[model samples]
Target: MFYNREIYKILPEKAEEFCDFFEQYIMPVQIKNGSKLVGKWLTESRDEVMVIWEYPSIEEYRKIIERVSNDQIGRKHQEQLKKNQPYLIKTEQFLTKRDKPERSNQNITVSGYIVNDVGEMLLVRTYWRSDTWELPGGGVEDGETLDHALCREIFEETGIIVKLFGITGVYSNGETIAIIFRGKRTGGELRTSEETKEVGFFPVDPVNLSTYVKRGKFIPRVLDAMNGQYIPYEAFQVRPYKLVKRYDGEI
Candidate 1:
């Protein structure tokens, strides 16, 4: 997607008049000329307004500009804008190219740590990997939120309904990004799904964990949850074939 961001700085007293002009005349004309209005926002101080217009691509944006230039309705709107020039102070615009949608090579997983009243943690042993026990979770489906995916996966694997508390930890191993959440059992009986060979809550201790959990990181994660230690969310920016930047949120 391509975006044209227009920033209008106006006199504080004329803010309402400018917004009225935009809604009554400018917006309709722009929409009719193939411009998609993404949104319009007012800054906290109310002295500035920002309008985001979207187009499929730079080519489409150029076409819209050309069409609007010759459009009769657009010309009329421009004339009206001149008549209300006192309400407008200054305007600035810039074009931005949005990242294209593409198939991702990275894998995202959402897992839950559901502790019962007795402090036992939920564990699952999959039929395909019966030698190692792990948290009841799975890959996130397309268009599914992290919380929804965690709830669905936990219920599917262990037949337990849980209320998520918050994020416990986020771990990335180059290719896979795993988001672990803390939760408590709300209701439901312990029943194994077709993919799971066993589902039950076990004592939340490192000794008991080492005997059942296969992943080495699971022990420390469990200990962290017991100690109430949490890592904040982190966002990353990646180029098509390269890593670009990573931003970590305050804990």
Candidate 2:
């Protein structure tokens, strides 16, 4: 895990000067404290500049802040700044560990309701099960965050990187926790994932509805998430209790 921060400013010319100071002074401090300089950029408008940095240890960020507060160069930079507010921001102390990342215990399954502007849901006929249309999403990985994984999955499954809005509902089926995040169509050529045979968006059509529900199971809860005004829950079972079957048949 890493601690990251962004500093935004309005002056483009000052951005170069700031980057110079950061590279010459701040970056050395960061390297000494075991941190990496991620990115530093000035926008095309020449009015906005942004800087990002990451630290393997949150303690490193704290130490940098402490050193910045006491350093003569830091004080001089502060006095030289024309902006009234902070052109340089400080983190209010945060901790992170790779073995157990922040929000590692947050029970979440990365899933999304792929919907178009007309409220139609995007469904994929997956090769994994058969001819059926289901919303694109899957289980979150152990080392990945829910939001990031969901976005990647949606792109991989539907060939579209939809902008995920806010959390619509949290669904749990006792076995798995599903985080239903809202989404809108961005821009991407439609394609199918390895699990999906056919992928496209369709309205609430009943003719194709039969294919979605197999073995008397309704999967429309994914759509309920996009309709808005759906009830939010921390945990929910989309299906009833079931027992697993073991086969002793010949291999």
Candidate 3:
């Protein structure tokens, strides 16, 4: 499906009036022209309104636009919009193709298990949780490869350079997928960033580590690397917004 996401940055106090105008004057005309009203939402601050319209394809979206341009009721709606323009500060629209329903809800995270020359594993204490020691990693940013994100996150949290060895494992918990990679410390000194309060190498075995490190979620991944077990990374070809190709290989 094709989506027309309309974002309106309106005067803070005029959000309700803008939404009322959309419902009464704009929605009916768009609906009559082969568009489905996906939903409308107001921001918590009451300063922005968002409306979503769906079409089967870009061609259908174009047809709807043409129909709305020619229809008498749509023309009247445009006139009303001019009179209410003062309420709207700015408007932005985005054309996007919707992904498959099954794949749309998944979130991806990348992590690195970097072991130093002394066999101690690198760990960090995040600013948000100074008491809990966790592996250095973060969510994959848009358009960034998993390995790149892993390296970037490791560097951001712990001031060190790492060379990725291979995939450690892929873990899933509900709607989230975590890709852990085995890495070796290559350069840089032990340091901390704004996001991290502490950065250092600790004993890999949970029995030899502090309580916080022993109870952290990355212990399993650390143990797996020490045992020389690595899962084959899966490669994917994302076409537009959907996964078009997937194969067993390094990502």
Candidate 4:
């Protein structure tokens, strides 16, 4: 349920004064009230500033913004801003959340950790998982073998017809299965489909991978593959994972 907002403000000539005020008074109050200032940048002209905010939920974001708006210190800061440079203009806002998990009666899924000749790995932004990125591949379709499914998913997602060089790892927990494959791009033009919005190769340490992987759940497997350590198939089938309940009886 995480959310984000991008705020763009155009200010007057005394932008340094506003920046100082923001850093000193506004940012502290926002953080204190539970809104994280994810990123911020200002122009040399001192006429505009762009800021990004992250919050667990819209309600939480509103609570923090309201608290800032109503604070005595915040009011004083706003007054000073108005007097010094009143041309502040807010441009837009954006909000997003994690994509819903894909469900299927058939439990097996075939995923790939495709690597290019330069050692970069491939990732995709799927239409189904809008605003989030993922390793390229998807469900094992009916009558499709695992290797075939892997090839099909890669082509469908990234338009790269590939030969499945080998299996990187296999993951299963009785209810779901994830078979990771390593492949070399064979032949095909990069194209888009209804399911994929974009696809490209990225270095193992991708700069923006956090937007897709909210937790560390799928990271270790990718890391292992990137390090040339192949995960044993038996390990996937043997790990014992169970759900636990807290003392309050809520899962």
lDDT of candidate 4 over 26-140, digit per residue (tens): 6766664446667888877667787777764555566667877876766876776676544565565665643665334335777887777787777777543445566777656
lDDT of 3 by residue, 1-251 (tens): 56788887788788777877887878877765556788988999998888888765566577678878876778998888778777775565756653534234455788887888887889888644456787888767556778888889898778899988678688886556888888789998888874676889987575665564645566676666566566655434555565433323232
Every model's Cα RMSD, please? 18.1, 17.5, 15.0, 16.5
Report the alpha-carbon TM-score of model 2 versus the true structure.
0.45
The sequence of per-residue lDDT tens digits that candidate 1 reaches over residues 1-251 is 56788887778888888889888777876775556788999887888999999765566577678767676767887888787677675565766643556544466888888889998989888654567888888767656667778889899778899987667778887656888877789999999865576899988586567788877866666665566555544333346554332212212
- Candidate 2, pairs of clashing residues: 10-47, 172-236
List where candidate 2 sits over 4 angstroms from the true fold. 1-108, 205-220, 230-251
lDDT (CA) for every model shown? 0.74, 0.58, 0.73, 0.64
Candidate 1, residue 157: the lDDT equals: 78
TM-score of each candidate structure, all chains considered together: 0.51, 0.45, 0.52, 0.46
From the highest TM-score down, the ranking of the candidates is: 3, 1, 4, 2
Off by over 4 Å in 1: 1-100, 231-251
Off by over 4 Å in 3: 1-103, 214-216, 234-251
Clashing pairs in 1: none
Q: Cα miss at 62, model 2 (Å)?
A: 46
lDDT of 3: 0.73
* Top lDDT prediction, candidate number: 1
